[model samples]
Target chain A: MNGSIADPKAVRRTILRNLRSALLELGSATKAELSDRLGVSFPTVSKFLGQMEKAGELLPVQLDDSSGGRRANRYSYNPEVMLGLALFLERTETSYIVFNCAGEVKDQGHAASVLTADITDFDALIAALVNKHPQISAVSVGVPAAVNNGRLIYIPEYEQFHDLDLKAHCEQRFQLPTVIENDMNAAVYGYYMARHQRSELQPSLVYLYFGQNGPGSGIMLDGNIMRGSSFFSGEVSFVPLYDQYNFGEAMRASHPHPRFPDGDLSVDAVARLIAVFAAVLNPHGVILSRHEANEGLLAQLEAASQAYIPREHLPAFILSDWEQDYLYGLQGLSLDLMLSREAGGN
Target chain B: MNGSIADPKAVRRTILRNLRSALLELGSATKAELSDRLGVSFPTVSKFLGQMEKAGELLPVQLDDSSGGRRANRYSYNPEVMLGLALFLERTETSYIVFNCAGEVKDQGHAASVLTADITDFDALIAALVNKHPQISAVSVGVPAAVNNGRLIYIPEYEQFHDLDLKAHCEQRFQLPTVIENDMNAAVYGYYMARHQRSELQPSLVYLYFGQNGPGSGIMLDGNIMRGSSFFSGEVSFVPLYDQYNFGEAMRASHPHPRFPDGDLSVDAVARLIAVFAAVLNPHGVILSRHEANEGLLAQLEAASQAYIPREHLPAFILSDWEQDYLYGLQGLSLDLMLSREAGGN
Candidate 1:
């Protein structure tokens, strides 16, 4: 069996494929176990393992004792061998991070530049990261807009981002796969991943990201992100709750005094604006975050939300404690997409 | 192989199992092909086919011709071998239907009984169905409420449905498998199944079902339903939309009524209610149905929804034209579950 495969590329692909299958099934596996399960000759498996180790694809772990025989060399995929880059672009700042395959944050970076400044600046920032870290395998960007087939369709106040080919630009620069998702959708994915890992809660989730602009929601049904037809399903800002006159006036009204003289309304004011919206679009819970969300604010919003429940039926409200790490969530989404493909053989 | 199996029960189970497997892999095998694939003697296969025919589980189709030989008998699974009953219970009426395995409607029944009505009446209705159609293999009931682990936690205005052992009661009386799901979740499933069969859309969906009470949402991510922590994630009615008020009340206040009495709302009132909800939660598209959404009502709702979206971005709304047969969707879910199990086994 070892001599059966002649092409080196085919052998490498086969080894990677088998290793992925083993990892997916058992989370980890030893070389001997993989050899037996894959029905490949032991020496062939050993050779592939050695090559993977040399390429930093597999890390040799401590040898496990065998029954009355020599110890077997145990190996696992190197988490750091490949990296994912995720960027969460807010109206005020851009949050970015590097994540390994196991979903651990390896490095983090942020820049306080308005996303609407210029597309060239955004490209430069991403290029700087790629130059700084060569191990990145994929890049995911989350923006506050409606995305249709990886294209930016609408960005409310930021008309500059409309029709931007963010995915193509990133992929062209880094020569890696790229994903561009709505900021709210990314928040939903981030919350879902964090909850799944840290809590024993049910896997289904409806995540509402309350920012100053408005509220955006993401639905996770049966542990999968629910993107509706046209990829704009979670847009909760349009639901009508108040008189069109009052709602429009409130939206256009000047920010109250010195706090926002620049006229950039704070999330709190947006929360108030959405309070009227909330009365109409009652959700399971509303999550507030400014890149990062705190428990105190969540509690405050939760209490405030209670006043709106007409029939004394208040849904649970949770404040996200996770670092306003929208980038990490994008990394998780990429990893999820990869893992799902591997698991389902699609 | 037939001689090797002595037990009649084993034979019956094997026939069922084989027939199901063959039907699932429709184009992959023929009766003769299955006979060879299962490694059963051809005569045994023939005999089992005969028995299944008597049981209405197998139907003889056109024969396949072998070169210069007698045409081989071709048999396929009879879709009507088993039946599923699906009941969608709303505040005002109950929509019920029976479906065959192929998702075709066999029969349907509707009643204008409120969900707040006595459980005994609901039971009586179910009993009447069982008496009328003794061949129903399973029953699935969809209610507009929050369910946690198969337990009804809340039913909003219909308090009588709260804490009801819906599953146990149905199963006990019919001695068949029964499942009770959130109505919105079931609606999403029905919508997804219908669209999947027609388009190349991604399997993940955020389904919003608009009604007078409020909009119900179901998240189907990656071909599976996402149930929230308490199995209530998709409960859109609780999502705070306007000025911290529930969307339902906000819509009522925003769109003042002259039609219905101050408190009692009509279907038109509900339609107006949904129009406001649709604006806030701009899902992929809103699905509208009458008491039991028919073709005419669906078109009307689609036309009405267009008014909500500014003349610029009106994504195509989908009308679920899947025969108005809830039972078929139930069967599809069951079949999908079974196929997933089989795929997992492989």
Candidate 2:
């Protein structure tokens, strides 16, 4: 929508894209209902639906209620026609989920740390999974490093993946559409999506993590995830929350891996970090990994941050299942890719 | 595009909106060119252009080149058909710019501080301006506090305007579309637009100003200006960059109003703030008010910030005319409002 229109084919593609998106959201509707919903002509909707039906993309659900006229047949999208793969590469393990367009997870599994091994191990893992699920049409990957449009731009710990275009590789290898995102970005997006469905309110949210790999954050304002100028947003480790030390240095000095707030120093550091997000972003909430969060830590953070800013201005501190959130976010991305690929004349 | 399409009327409105936008950007275009550029049918473009021409919204510009075919007529948008009013209510004075659709400044003036004066003074100022320029179709106002959808949610200095839907009041009184934005938000947006046209690269930028009112910031990440939950973003005064003092407290303690970094204490505080944005956002640039920034001060900041974070990660710090940027941003918002209003079946 931001660029110049290319041609009529592109315009038709957009209509089909909107129709598919409407159907996905509506679940089932009559031809007239879809035409009205899409603001497109009845003939256009009828033609596209017929074409998709022939391609096994649509299912006849039921007959619409008759209102003193002939009943129209209701059509539903075939969720099973497209499958998505979502995976996250972590230092200890690689986890994945295979899901349908409707977000129903069909299978989930884990593999050895592909980051420590090599790119071949990453390839083999995806290859094996794709072989198992032939219907998988799209893939989304989550990584611990900063990602620039599917390329690993900053992976100091994993040299094997550094500078690799993981999305291009996966898409080329499997002939499937793929996307690559930072782990924290995906996690926050997943959390935002889960909560957004219930409230339907745009939220400003932050996801923070002190992981085995490093410290990072994910920022979402008004439901849009922020990837910085070079996709370097959420690299909170570099944050100079204190004059004496950066967030990462402070964390490393005060605590051990995974379990944070080993002492008051780390607590102070984490609290200061929370205050930074509160003051700068004023998000609705700040989410932390459930594994590292508890009632005690949250209360301590709240009390500590109050020293810097008013308590009322502080965002709500929450703990979420980071693993689930990350995978769900990846799944969401993959499903979108599936839809967009199909809508782009697949 | 994100919402359910309502009907054919709404769809027609969207096509018209796109056509208007395309024409404005292209300056002038032939029917064939517009159709190809908008991905709409030739008949649709031709019909709408004819209607707009009849409405005096378009002007016949020139004829297109011919290559073994008939030459076509090129049409241009009538910039004089619509005008916008952009005004910023500052503590010192209220500055205004009456601009046409093409961003040409037709008139500029200043009035007494509306924030310090009563609300009637504000009304009278707008009335005088609108009376002089009867062609004005939209209004955009910039204020010094947090804004939530045009309502002044946080204006502690001006209690009379607090919680007032300034946009609603302006539109109701003037019978024109209106928008209200925060001073810093408008400034950053204006600067972004000015730079975006030249480079066309989406930028992550920050605008910082220590003014007579208070310290605040504007954040634009990847071309989107971030308004946080409750619209409390850019309140950088509360950011706890130091254990001993917040940014506002440190600035007030070391420096007088209108000037900054008068001593080492304020310098350290400002550097720490820049470091915070860098480590967290990794923005491409951080902009400062030209009035406050000097070569000596910037050098001091650049060196001091390196004490907190790496030099390479620090965003490029530059001085900008905050006043011009603020007005330009408001003008842009007003123009968009005008177009959107005309496209909404007006």
Cα lDDT tens digits, model 2, B1-346, are 3234334555666777777777888898999888877767788799988888888888766888886799889899988888899888988899899988888999998989999988899999989999999888889999888888889999887888889988888878878888999889989999988667522678888999998667989998777787776566677888766545678887876744322334557888889898888877779999998899888899999998898777777889888899789878898888777776553223
Lowest-sum lDDT 10-residue window in model 2 chain A: A255-264
Candidate 2 clashing pairs, residues 3+ apart or interchain? none
Question: Which candidate has the top score in DockQ?
Answer: 2
Q: What is the lDDT of candidate 2?
A: 0.81
Give the number of colliding residue pairs in candidate 1.
41
- Candidate by candidate, in order, the iRMS in Å equals 12.4, 5.4
Runs in model 2 deviating more than 4 A are: A1-80, A101-105, A255-263, A340-346, B1-49, B57-78, B255-263, B340-346
DockQ, prediction 2: 0.40
Give me the candidate number with maximum lDDT.
Answer: 2
Separate clash counts for every candidate: 41, 0
- For model 2 the local lDDT of residue A327 reads 75
The 0-to-1 C-alpha lDDT of every candidate, in the order given, reads 0.58, 0.81
